[model samples]
Target: MTTPSARVVLKPKRARPLFAGHPWVFAQSIARVEGSPEPGDEVEVVSHEGATVGRGLFNPSSAIRARLYRWDGGPLDDAFWKARLETAVQLRRDVLGLDARNSAYRLVFSEGDGLSGLTVDRYGSCLVALFSSLALHRRRDAILDALRELTGAEGIIARPDRAVAKEEGLDVGDVRIVGTIPEDLTVFENGLSYKVDVLQGQKTGFYCDQRENREAVARYCLGKRVLDLFCFTGGFALNAAKAGAASVRAVDSSAPALATARENARINEVANVEFEQGDVPKILERLKAAGERFDVVICDPPKYAGHARDLAPALGAYARLNHAAVDVLSPGGILATCSCSGLVDRATFRDVLANVAEHSRRPVQILEQRGQGPDHPVSAPCPETDYLKCLIARVG
Candidate 1:
């Protein structure tokens, strides 16, 4: 093992999180740097007592000053990356049975796979890699090489999260293609096929994190009228239709997404689903005013809160969105509501649901609570990895 050129020393007694296996070393915890290290450089992290804690990527510009990748002192090389990627893929295949029903699944879930800020999703033969940190972005070549060698994927693409890049003080360009990226890529989830525009799709072309939740929501849709809010590409709507929904109305503000949803519905030969393009909140109010009611309503909105400061407003927005969804639900209807905000804990989300039920004048019975699919595993020490929350309740 080679000695790291840079070293980060933590403040007095501030290495508790690192010792506890939490990967992030916040700017506040860092006391000083012993060597000159640029952003995206590997650095040794040590406690105030001068005991080595771990080796991590240093980013002085980010609030997360350092993100530990290895607790044991070792060099990060081709072999290391290959082992990490292989281990992540093996877990998905063995534990999640990812290849059995779905061609699209999260192969690596950032910190969950011991690789912070690097997410790789497989869309059939294509692999979409998202680098959220400057450190990972800088090592894209090595990572992509390992991915190609391990997965034997036909095409690999890089879609750096613009928000994350901006936060990390990195100026990243447009999406870069590494191999022969097919113009139209289709992936299967729960035995349902949907076309993926991997080159220009949302979050690696599809939201594979909600794969199991979508399937689970289908169980209650049999012979029921369903409403899928923010139904991007019709994952839940199609699943519900496949489960024998009487009628499924999928609503989203994005015309392109709705078009894709319609295409997916046609491809699946599911005629019960109707795609609508409009503001979801306004459309919900319109549906309520028109006396339209659904037996099963799903509200899976995007992340409302990204940081601590946005928590208050996000709670309010979630409450309003859920209230609107509940207002259009028939008595004894099922509501599958979700929040993908990491800042909002399960308790806070449940509280928001309760407040929505109260405001909507509907009493709710909790039926089931769900998180992201098993493929998107969460690390015990990193709470950020546990983001998605879905609550299924019966309202009357």
Candidate 2:
């Protein structure tokens, strides 16, 4: 008869607006299943009205039940991959003008580019591809082939070190796809050089998401003695020092990241920065106890909340970090704080900062607020569209 169909049919309530182009289908929204489907199974998503909405990978265990890859009812063959890969490359070149810059940039940004859960970063001649979803990991050969055929860059490497893969029930592994991917590479941003450790560093070697934020911070850091807390690879510290900061101390627990941070400073020939490897909380405590104050402080911590349940503890961490940051700020000094946790919305982050200021008894005025750079665009209807939230405030 018919090949045993594996698909999900949404209920009326579940399908109401999903057909409107939302990429995510929540687990609670699933109404019925036509046949047995394993996690990461490719399926046809249908509305209650019996209209096909899209083709996606189904992950029953995940809150995100389905991640839509193509809304048009079409075969996902080699042609589809070729077209999507080309479009992804062209978007960066045509829309973001990435060709004019030699610095690293996101080649693919998951759902933002309509390719769910696939992230790629280009560092000089090297490429780091992150395949977090089982759907993409299964098709790793084709994806790698597309990268080789399309970009023709020097090298392509796989970065499955991210935690997202574990949620998809996949084991993490690092694979070298093509060419010679170095252990350490250098990237230029805003005329400053940063040494990136692709094998061990965070998210595809460098924080491409913070490109614009670093540029903005560089504008205000001149003549300031800055303290960068939770400074992985010292992106902010380098920016601040390159902007003529009197001095900068970059702190992180990973000695490897700090070592790269030091090399990054040296690459830029910026001599004013110092790297300290330790726990950020303890370091902050010691600094405050030592009566050491800074004219500018940057707190860019990792994701404290991966989900809604983690928000309480995340807020506590944010508050404690900002409290110490504020306590050691010189009068009228600036504090640039950021939270990468998608669960921590802008409102919640601002509230926590205000609470920190209140607790520290410091008079604070917010100078500016920013989200992820233009490269990381947000969809209007999706709350998850925005992730990075940063606040630049002056404390007295």
- The numbered model that scores best in lDDT is 1
Q: List the residue pairs that clash in candidate 2.
A: none
Candidate 2: segments with Cα more than 4 A from true spot: 1-4, 174-176
Question: Top model by TM-score, which number?
Answer: 1
Per-residue accuracy of model 2 over 1-396 as CA lDDT, tens digit each: 122158788878677566766788887788888888887677888888888888888777677778787776776666787788888888888988976874788887776777777888888788898887777677778888888788888888885646786787667764656888876677888787788778777778788888888878777789999999888887898889888899999899988888888887777788888899899989888998999999999989889998879989999988988988888889989999999998889998999877977788888888889988766767664567699998998888
Note the clash tally of each candidate. Answer: 0, 0
Q: For candidate 2, what is the lDDT?
A: 0.82
lDDT for each residue of candidate 1 in 229-328, tens digit (9 for 90 to 100): 9999999999999999999999999888888999999898899888899999889889989999999999999989988799999999998988888888
For all predictions, the C-alpha RMSD in Å is: 1.4, 2.2
For candidate 1, the 10 contiguous residues with the lowest summed lDDT are: 169-178
Listed in order, each prediction's TM-score against the native is 0.97, 0.94
* Candidate no. 2 TM-score: 0.94
